[model samples]
Target chain A: MSWQLGIEHLRDLARGAAILGTGGGGDPLIGRLLVEQAIREHGPVTVVDPDELADDAFVIPTAQMGAPTVIVEKIPRGSEPVGALRALEKHLGRHADATMPIECGGINSMIPLLVAARTGLPVVDADGMGRAFPELQMETFSVYGVPGSPMAIAGEHDETVVIDTGTDNKQMEWLARGITIRLGGVAHIAEYSMTGAEVKRTAVPRTLSLGLSIGRAVREARAVHADPVEAIRDALAPTLYSHLRVLFRGKVVDVERRTLEGFARGRARFTSYDGTSELELRFQNENLVAEVDGEVVCTVPDLICVLEGDTAEPITTEGLRYGQRVTVVGISTPALMRTPEALAVFGPSCFGLDVEFNPVEDRAETPAGVATSLAP
Target chain B: MSWQLGIEHLRDLARGAAILGTGGGGDPLIGRLLVEQAIREHGPVTVVDPDELADDAFVIPTAQMGAPTVIVEKIPRGSEPVGALRALEKHLGRHADATMPIECGGINSMIPLLVAARTGLPVVDADGMGRAFPELQMETFSVYGVPGSPMAIAGEHDETVVIDTGTDNKQMEWLARGITIRLGGVAHIAEYSMTGAEVKRTAVPRTLSLGLSIGRAVREARAVHADPVEAIRDALAPTLYSHLRVLFRGKVVDVERRTLEGFARGRARFTSYDGTSELELRFQNENLVAEVDGEVVCTVPDLICVLEGDTAEPITTEGLRYGQRVTVVGISTPALMRTPEALAVFGPSCFGLDVEFNPVEDRAETPAGVATSLAP
Candidate 1:
């Protein structure tokens, strides 16, 4: 169904998003409140189908990249994306005809509305990538040959700088991140310029609707007190599912970070409520892999999500810390991310994992390394 | 300075490049032979000034970025930069009019000639970065707003991928480096598409000649039996000779490398000829500083060049190793690199110095870590 931002719809959208966010998207309640409040204050967002787009329409997609943990405490100034959009418009010498999500999970899902509301641009019901990625260039647009540079990327206080990685994503990342670090850790980026022609060719068609639908299913489950996770799994129809491994649900035991080329990279360890088991999540941007008992289980391209222990609610990486109860969950990559190019973008190796590619099935067969479960 | 080259010019260019390669450009011997043979078999390269560029003059820049050690063992299978050029030109719908260096240091300076001569494009008198940076986007062009996307990068066997990193050098770096690792740790890239206007704004002017002159100075010093270290010093005209520290010639005792985000970041310890003292070189890509007896002398933005031991020749970071004799030299950043913008680009903090900027003068009086050296 199209967006109607009624309390019921917002409820459903949040629930469904929890399931579909697969482990990486932040808890949807906050975003739901935000989107709902924004809608309540501004009116419900109207989602336009890509097929409805005019041929000459300009479409822009935007998102936040960096450690998810950083996003929680720092909170976006909310002006960065808007500023980036305005800058892009200035550069293009025209207003964007439309805009869409670059990623449909976590804060990114809500960001489209915030930006759309500000730009007066229709929010397209689509996304560039079907799932989360560690870097800006991993989007499907790059796979389809879209440019990611000369992009209007803004930081806190509306500090905006356009980057032209000139086909070098590493350089582009360094340039944007260097500026962002100069501004602070988090940044709002508006990247991936496309003609309607190219957008049609590359975008994950109707992903915004998928986001909405995923949101809806989770709502229905919670309303009926059903399993929201199952509701999401059924909705996405993911090609495969590995046996789930619940890593831990106690408190964050440790967190350490190192700045390399100015990006936050490090690891976090959490202990179980039982105080007997421990879970470790290693990440650069999105959580890449999870290890229990010192054994690798979930890997990149696959999803490593965290939830509030009792409620089974989603937990953005940044929200994780000591005394925070979190249950870790893993989701296999949808068949879309399994594409060679997609894997090339998010594979285990992409995260510097030394292990060779082991598809979801093989991943499950491997024993979970939960600390208490170890042979000790 | 203009166009047209005879056999003599190719020999001069190659020989001059090797002399200046600072011992890290890979053995110029084979590459020089290949290029020399290419020029001899075909014709000499015509060097054209950027001003002479035709509006449609197809120009591409090429370079090697990785553990330089890998480049020697894995000689190109006769593709790479040429393959990148083919992929780029194929996408551009035009033949290249010229090819140029990514940077005029080490082997990278000569790598572009492989593509230039192979594609029949004149060698350009411009380079992307005035000096070598460890990562792809650390170019003079990147600082000036040139991007690294919409690129043609590939492996030796010509596994070409035409990519647009969308203006984030970080993305380009991630993608190119991902490809490089996928291709076994070496990828040749041809990037930076300018409308001549962009190039004029961003590309460092006269860096190639600067390199040639620096290389020439070293050659002249050796011929006259002058200290090559003094020759490079004479060539660069350091702001403070008082801070000059010709650290001891020595052999590496240990090396530590961490392949985080595809960069080899670590430090090296060396024992001088006296064997009682020690020198350590800290590196990200190029050497950023030199410490003798635990004192910091050179720092980033300033240059910490390592020339060969005895011979006092320049040695690239990757060229350094255990049991290899090397003389450490330091040079200050050009005034251009001293600007806040330039310092921001290559400052001590940029390379993880974690200190305030300090000029070479005070750096000598106290040394890099002495609190004597702070990033400005």
Candidate 2:
């Protein structure tokens, strides 16, 4: 059965999503409209719990992979993803029974809802990653040894490819990037084939609900004129909370962004409150780490979310500008990305930092309600 | 029927192909050896006449498209072209009647031969262009409105992509390049589907035979006391010989090469006996032009061939260096790429030259044998 969010929750959902999006999702207005349109056109997509999926349900996760700049220009022709999925099934000689989101940030999270409605597949209440981490292989799937190849990549002119390569996840990303650049820099892929068993084991189940809860908290916090940031802490309660850690955040005094060897790279240095201490952010999409002076204050598999402290709006790593009032808030990643393999790709070294990866729990206690995986 | 070429001819073929490769084709040694190995394995490929094929033949032309720098680093898996072609035909639901060389230079010229030996597809005698110009639309097919999008791009990882977009050839290149960059810079492609009728109308027919002739001319000229330049003149006779202007013969004083906007773009200003006239070479995969002394010397559709003035050993554009005594020779383009559509992509202006594109006959008269549409 479909569970609908009334108009009242939609604002909060969007605001909170923008926060969980961790600054990589495009403007929430467009994403909101797309989702609102999809819901309006096809009724609401039924979000089924991962437990509801059959053990053998054909589950595939989907997302748009490549440069974000390209995504804005090449408005998808609407049917490419569904076309890719059907093409994938045709190539595989079977249909997927369910679908999941590949990333929780940006339009990636809501993309599954539209795709699920169109494919008649239930949306798995889970995602490959709890927050964005740049490439396809940076997901929990890869850390868990899931293959990103043998998926379908489609172009608007109906060129659908069933891509299978011996390439490691990183290499496959390089190949698909050609299509993205050629298609004006964005490519949509239907990937991450799994059974319900695999999804239940590997995914950060119901993180959207977590996103929804965080979104609602921010909305409710604002409704009563409470601290939206504090509201987020309560909503993501038990998983994370507001902090008073004094790290400098103001205008991005300088930013250096470059895509080299297939990775979007660069760092941002900002001056907060007369530039007493500089706040620096190094990222490859979602904020990977924030540093004060020379020390890494926070790192990946943990959210390094920057919000307009007063407005609570998510700020992208690329667009971080000078003189913006930012509050760098950290959230522990959902279990999916916390795996060591995922960390190897998202952690300090991935961003060229020298710090050893420390679990989110080691640095800060999670709020009361979220499930925390006990360390091995 | 099979044609015969002695080792002497193959040597010249290799040399001339390298020179004609502009600066982008991989080192000719690889193509030469693969060919030598093929000759050693299954005998030399039968060089068919343009009229040898059936009228209803499905001709599939193929080549490599991406950054040349990435090619040598990521060696082709060799079996990729066949994989790309087979995939194309699988999509087309028919077997190809013949294979055509997409261009008559370095990596592109030999690729069709490789596919032919591997897939049992008969090789077409013609190529889409007589020499090389950068970009897919520079070909005779695109000049005649051929599509570049639906082409299959396959890499060493065996990752295969059939890219088809609604965008024109130029935009198609832009998008394909993104994927190419994503894929670590190089990939093999089998593209440009055409009927036998289309092949007859637009391609630079018998260009391989011409390449062989040029190769033989160089070898024979060097074997005896005859001038190697004269042999080159004879080998490239008729079509390419139309421009008999010898720009200069002196050691290169300076060489500079740079990659920009996906092209090996830079001018090699040379110190020649003719008071240092610079040779400007621009190539995507092949050299597009050779201008000398503030004059409109040579342009696309026309071949700008460079060689060691004394020995006739071909000098590739990218491989050109300081202290080499070289001669820049111009050969006219086939009528195919001289059309308005072709001019838009490969003409003088296409390469950012200010001069209008004129046939070689308008520029200079050849010694003899070189075919000129202007002569007819």
Most lDDT-accurate candidate: 2
- All candidates: TM-score: 0.57, 0.84
lDDT per residue as tens, model 1, A1-376: 3344344455555544544454445445555555665666566666787777777788888776555555555666566687788766665566787778887666677777777665566787777666566567677787667877657666564444555455665555545665455455567777786778777777767766666676676656778887665565676664333334444445678877554543546788976655665678886646777777677767777667776554456665555566665656666655656788877866778678886655544654322224333212
- lDDT against the true structure, per candidate, is 0.63, 0.66
Model 1: share of native contacts present? 0.00
Interface RMSD of each: 11.2, 3.3
For model 1, the DockQ equals 0.04
Comparing only chain B with the true structure, the TM-scores of all models are 0.83, 0.87
lDDT for each residue of candidate 2 in B1-376, tens digit (9 for 90 to 100): 5464334456667666665564556555666666665656655566666677666778888777665655555667577778778767765667888788887777777777777766666778788767766677667777776675567777666777665554366665665565565566666777788888878877878877766667677777778868776776655556633445454455566666665555666666554454534555555445666555545566666666666767767676567778777766666665666778878877778767677777756774322212111111
Candidate 1 residue runs with Cα over 4 Å from true position: A1-12, A33-43, A48-71, A77-109, A115-376, B1-15, B18-42, B48-62, B73-102, B118-121, B124-284, B287-315, B321-376
Among these predictions, the greatest DockQ belongs to 2
